[model samples]
Target chain A: MKVGILGPRGTYSEIAARTEFGEEIEPVTYPLITDVAEAVEDGEVSVGVVPVESLREGSVGETLDALAWLDVKVKSEIVVEVDHKLLGTKDSKLNDIKQVLSHPQALAQCRKFLRKNLPDAELISVTSTAKAAKQVSKLRKKYMAAIGSSGLADLYDLKVLQENVQSGQENETRFLCLSKEDSEPTGDDKTSVVFYTEEDRPGILYEILQEFATRNINLTKIESRPSKKALGDYLFFIDFEGHHEEEPIKEALEEINEKVATLKNVGSYPKRF
Target chain B: MKVGILGPRGTYSEIAARTEFGEEIEPVTYPLITDVAEAVEDGEVSVGVVPVESLREGSVGETLDALAWLDVKVKSEIVVEVDHKLLGTKDSKLNDIKQVLSHPQALAQCRKFLRKNLPDAELISVTSTAKAAKQVSKLRKKYMAAIGSSGLADLYDLKVLQENVQSGQENETRFLCLSKEDSEPTGDDKTSVVFYTEEDRPGILYEILQEFATRNINLTKIESRPSKKALGDYLFFIDFEGHHEEEPIKEALEEINEKVATLKNVGSYPKRF
Candidate 1:
C-alpha cells in the first residue's frame, strides 16, 4: 500500500510513516499535511500520515479541520519522541555558527539551547526542518546550521553538531494514520469524533458528556475550536476510550447525536501508547 | 498610567492598546508577549495589553500559559479588525519587489495576495511587522517590501503598495487587558477560568459542566491544553457568561473548586461584541 507523508524526506512525518509501515515501504511524499490528506481522499495513496498533536503546539488545526471537512477515517495512531539536533556542514563548528534555520515550532522547541550557546546567532524560520537541512546542504555556509533529526542529516548529507537540543526533553508528537477504510474493533480501542452543540443553551455540553459518563466510558481528550460563525460559537472535538461497535458506546453516541447539532465520527482505531 | 504592548510600535497589539487607553496614552514596547505579561506582573506598567485570541489562530498559547503562570487578572478584552497592507520604500516599485517581509501570521493571512501578485517574491518571516517595516526603511532596497498596517506606513515613512491583503475580510483578533487588579462586576460580564480534572474519571468533566448548566450560565469557549505532566493530562481553559461576583456564578465556581484537582479564576470582565 502506498502511504503519503509530508516530506522532501527526513521530516518527522516521514519518520512516523516508517515507524508504522516499516522503513522499506517507500511512502510517497507531499509538501504539506493538507496535501497528504487530499492524496488519501483522492485515492492517490492508500493511507496518509500527518502530525495531529504535540506537547508544545497542542493540536494541529489543519489536520483536524481536514479530517472534519473530508470523508476520511483515522485508521491508527503513532507517537514519536521528538529530538531536534543541530546539524551543519562537516566543516562548520557549533560555536562559530552565526545563524540557525528550521520550522517555527522546531526553533521554538530548541529556543533555550540557541539562546544560551549561540547567543549571537540569528534564527530564520523556514517551511520545515527537513527543508532547513536541505538548504544548509546547498548553501554550505561556514557559519550556518539547522535544527532537525539525525534522519535529516543522513538525507541531506549533513553532520549532527549537537544532539537533543530542545528545551523540553519530554516533547512528543502524536501522528494520525488517515484512510478511507475503517478499522475493525480491538479490545482496547479509541473513537474520535467531533460534535456541535444543539443550540446556544446552558448545560448542553453537560447533556452530551453525561452520555459517556453514564456508560462508564473514559474520555481521553476534549477540545473546542471556534465554529467561525461567531465569537462564542464552538465545535467540540472529543476522543474517548471505546469502539463504536460496542453496545454501550453505540448507545452513548445515539444519545449524543440527538443532543448535538451535528456529529461526525472521525474514526475508531486501536489506541497507541 | 503606562500600558505595555508587543512592539517596536505599529503592531496590531499597539492598535488594541490605543483603542482601550486612547491615542494619547504613552505605551511601553516589549519585544515578546511574555515580556509584556512580565511587565504587568512586575508593576512596570499600570496594565499590559497582549493578543490572546484571533479568528484564524484560535488562541495565543503563550498568552494563555503566561496568564496561567503569572499572578495577574484579565481586566478587559478588546477586539480589533485586522487589515493587512503591503508597504514599500519610496523608490520601490511593486513589480520590482523581489521579497516580502513580515511576521509569520501576517504572511499566512496574505497568502492569496502574495501568490497572485508577487509570485516570485521571497517571503521572509520577521519578529514583527513593525520590525519588517523598519528593516525595509533602513535597507532602502527597491526589491524589498513589507506586509503591515497602514499605520506602519506613516510611522516608517513608507508608501502603501496595496491595502486589505488578508484572505479573510472579517479577520479579527481579541486582545486581553492584563493587570494585577481584578475587574468589578458588570451587568453583562464574562468569567474566565482554568481547571484540572480530579482524576481520569469517565464523567468528571460532565459534572463540572453541570455546575454551570444548572445555574443557567452559558459557556462561551472551552479548550484543553496539555498539562505538560503526561500525554492525556489536560488543563481546561473555559470562558462562560456572567460575572463571578453574581450569586449563581459564585456558587457554581465554589462548587467546581471543590470537585476539581485545582481551579483558578482568571478574571471577570465585560463581554465585548
Candidate 2:
C-alpha cells in the first residue's frame, strides 16, 4: 500500500501513517496538508494521513480547510503520543546547547522545558521537526540541538540529550487518513460534518445543533472557523458519535441540512479518541 | 503609556497596538503571547495587544490559552488589514529571489503567490514576519526575500518588490488589548466567556447554547479548544452580543454556571466586527 504524509520523514505524520499501515507500506511525502489531501483525491496514493489536531495546539486549520474544501473522505483516525526529545550531536551535552530548532508548534509545545533549561538559547523555527533534525545533523555543531521524536535521532544520527521535553504529561496528536471512500459501518464510528449558515442571527447554530441533541447523538467536537469571506462569518465543523449511514445520524443530518445554507458530510470513520 | 506587543517591530501586533493607542505609546516587545499577557497581569505595561484571530488563519491558539488561563481582561478589539508585500534589498529584483522567509501563517496566507512566482525557492518559516524581514535586511542577499506588512520595508530598510502578495484581498486580523479590567458597558458591546463541561455526553453543549438561545442572545463566535487534559476533552470559548453587566447576559451566565463544571467570563469589550 502507498500512503501520503506531511513530509521529511520521521515526523509525527509518518509515525501515524506507519502505526495505521504498518512498516512495510511505501510512504509518499507532501509539503502541505492540502497537497496530501489532493494526492488522495487524485488517487496518487491509496490513502493520505495528516495531523488533524494536537492536544497542545488545538486543531490544525490547514487540515480542517482541506477537509472542508477537498474531494476526499476520512477513512480512519489515528492518535499518536507526541514524545519530544532533545537531540544533539554525539559530542554535545545538554549544557552546551545554545540554540534549539523545531517546528513552531513543537517549539511551543516544549516552551516550559526550553524556558527552564535553555533560557538563553535562540529558538529557530523550521518547517518541520524532521527538517530541524536534518539541519542539526548536517551542521554537527555542539551548540545546536533539535526537539523531536526519538525516531529522528536514529534517522538523523543524533543523540538524545533529554527525553520527554514536551510540556504536559499527555501530549497526543490526532491524525486523519483520507481516501476516495470512507470506511464501512464498523458499528462503532464517528461522523464529521461541515456547515455554513448564511444568516447572522441569534440561535441559528443552537437550532441546527438541536437536531443531534434531540436524537441523543453525542458530539465529539465542534469548532467554528472563519469562512474567509469576513471576520464574523464562520463555517462550523462538527464530529459526532455515529456513522453517517446510521439511522439516527442520517435523520439528524437531514434536519441540519434544511436549516443551514450548505452542508458537507466530510466522512465517517471508527472512533479513535 | 507602555503597551506590550509581539515584536521586533513592524509586526501586525505592533500595528494593532499603534492603531488602538496611537503612535506615541511606548511599545514593549515580548517573544510570546503568554509573555504579553503576563506583562499586562504584572502591570509592567498599561496594556498589551495580541492578535486573537485572523480571517484566513482562524483563532490564535496561544492567545486563546492566555485569555483562558490569565487574569488579564480584554479592553478592546483591534482589527488590522493584513497587506503582505514581498520585501527585498533595493539592489534585488523579483526573479533574483531564491528563498522566501516569513512566519508560518504569513507564508501560508501568501502560498499562492509564492507557488506561482517563486516555485522553486526554499520557503523558510521563522518565528515572526518582522524577524524574517530583519534577517533579510541584515543579510542583504539578492536571493533572499521576506513577505510581511509594507511597514516592514521602511522599518528594515528594504524595498517592496511587490505589493499585496497575500492570496486574498480581504485578509484581516483581530487583536485584543489586554488590561487589568474590561471595558465598561457600551450600549453596543460583546462579551467573551470560557467554560468546561466535565461530562462527555450528548446535549451538554447544546443545552449550554440553549441558555443563550432562549435569552435571545446572539453569539458572534463559538470555538472548542482541547482542555489540554485529554484529546476529547474541550473548553468552549463563546463570544456574544452584550456586556456581562447586562441583566439578560448575567442571567444566562448564572444558568450556564450551574450547567458547566467551570465558567469564566473572559471580558466584555466594544464590538469591533
The numbered model that scores best in TM-score is 2
For candidate 1, write residues A1-273 as lDDT tens digits.
Answer: 688997668889989999999977868987556678889999999999998877666677667777777888999999998989999999988887998999867887887898799989988767689889989999999788999999999989999999989986447889999999768998999999998764677887888888898889988888776666554456888999989999999999999898777899998999885
lDDT of each: 0.85, 0.89
Model 2 lDDT, residue B142, Cα? 96
User: What would the TM-scores of all predictions be?
Assistant: 0.85, 0.95
Interface RMSD of each: 3.0, 2.2
Best DockQ among the predictions, by candidate number: 2
Candidate 1 chain B: 10-residue stretch with minimal lDDT: B225-234
For candidate 1, what is the TM-score? 0.85
DockQ metric for all predictions: 0.42, 0.57
lDDT tens readout by residue for model 2, B1-273: 899998668899999999998989899988678889999999999899998877555677788888888898999999999999999999999999999999877888888999899999998877789989999999999999999998899999999999999887448889999999999997999999999888788899999999999999999888886686654466999999999999999999999999988899989999988
